[model samples]
Target: MNTLQHGFQLNYGNTDVMLLFEGQPDHLVPCTSQILLDSDLFLVAGRMVGHSFLHGGPALAGISEAVVDVLFGASPDMTTITVEDCPDLERRQTIQLLDGNKDLSEEEKDAVWKLADMWDLPGVTSDNRKWLFSRLLQHAVLGRTDKQIKQFRRGLKETCIWQLLTERKDVIPLMFPRERDVEIKPQMVLDQILWPLETTNEDEDYPVETRCRIAGYLREFIATASQSSLRGLVQFWTGWEVPSSDMQLEIVQGSLPKASTCFKSLRLPGHYTNFKDFSQDLNACVATCDTGFGLV
Candidate 1:
């Protein structure tokens, strides 16, 4: 039996095998026959053995033809593998293998999670977390049992999956629908409308259009809003003082023409003599009038 530097060896049973080490504090790692046979190391060792048999090489100088055939032929026995000493590399290889295998058994998945925990691995990487999330989402859409769904939710929360889900605008509503809330806050809806306008990278006119549309929406939203919601909207708009175009200002003012009335009627925060006084101050700070008298 000859040993190679790269952990390859020709065993007495005429099998070509490559030793694999896994995990930290390296030990002779044993694995299932299927895992060992399916591994890249085994494939590479088989190729090397076949190449050696086809062309006379120094590595095969003393090996018998029958031995070479057995090593190179189908149904090669890789069971007599020795322990190698590269635990970190082997562990990473195992992780990549497991991560790529979407059809893993429940036991296999448990093993993967255990390995991740042992390594203190954060599921922040796309490769590490995407598959798990995909599986969880599939289970959710397919109507898993309540207990199973809760387990998946717990796992996702532990990995900060909600933060990632928020970035996916399409999935956020599905995962966290407004209907789930006992009482949806008007500020949350307002924030949703304003967030894009504040963070947009488009031309300045885009924000003007967005703000005008938001103002119109708010006006309609407040019409059916609870007293508390109306108060919230008034309090929010009062602190906003960015200058806008005349058309944009006009549309926004048109939407909330009765904001001051609502504030006073509800006894909301902030003091204003009347709705006209509040409207004048807001319009002046937000945009100039047709007469060029208000702040531009």
Candidate 2:
């Protein structure tokens, strides 16, 4: 899914045309490309989004809400189209000029005129600029790309999620989450950790002080880690791109931090004398996982 997001940001075949999505990275809309459409890229992208949703993978974040509204079969009027939705900078700026009180010079108006002609819209007069702007915004963001949106919907239905999506409109935010839509906090990861009571300092049968210290270091690292670091830590701990319900973390007396992906358990060395050592070793452990390991 991460790779998919990166690929979605790129142009197709040096054409400056979008393959699956358009606009800025944070406000992407589906792109209409006949070549890609013939190859079923939109359908496959939608199916991947559905599959990721069903299998505890990352949400397809950064898609514009207006586009999402359209994706889920909402009327074009139901969405609020803005200049930001227009992918072309020159066109977006032109659309913005339509709203300003300053009259556009002939040069400024030329691009808008061409776009209007291309879309079969009437030439803009003071009285009609607003209407023309609305139509141009619609055509740029929605009208020209309606077919791609349809294929996206059809692809999602192929994954058997169309009914669920249509029936529950509220979960739309979760389906294509914005960064603000889902914030992963330190306490959230802490809460998910499955700790062994025996490793606590309160346990009398064993000298568990090292485990307690290492666990404190773990908490501090998690609390101070950046969002990307935290995400990678979670993935390393659980083999899940996103957080899961059962994250079993342990502190053993010897060795670098290790993990059992199948069990969603992360084992850290209890011998760490300081937070720096613990954090460094833990980061090293998370940074690499070329092979698998397990506890006997």
- Could you tell me how far off, in angstroms, the CA of residue 276 lies in candidate 2 after the best superposition? 2.4
Screening candidate 2 with a backbone cut-off below 3 angstroms (N, C-alpha, C), the clashing residue pairs are: none
Distance from true location, Cα of 245 in model 2, Å: 1.4
lDDT of candidate 1 over 57-148, digit per residue (tens): 21212221212222222121321211122234544344544444366666656655665555454432336565543333222222122232
Worst 10 residues of 2 by lDDT: 287-296
Q: How many backbone clashes does candidate 1 have?
A: 0
Name the best candidate (by lDDT): 2
The models' CA-based lDDT, in order, is 0.34, 0.78
Off by over 4 Å in 1: 1-182, 191-214, 222-296
User: On a 0 to 1 TM-score scale, where does candidate 1 land against the true structure?
Assistant: 0.15
**Model 2 lDDT vs. the true structure?**
0.78
Off by over 4 Å in 2: 8-19, 22-26, 32-35, 199-207, 253-256, 284-296
Give the clashing pairs for model 1: none
Tens digit of lDDT per residue, candidate 2, span 61-158? 88877888888878997688878888878778877878766889997788788888988988888899888888889888999888888888888899
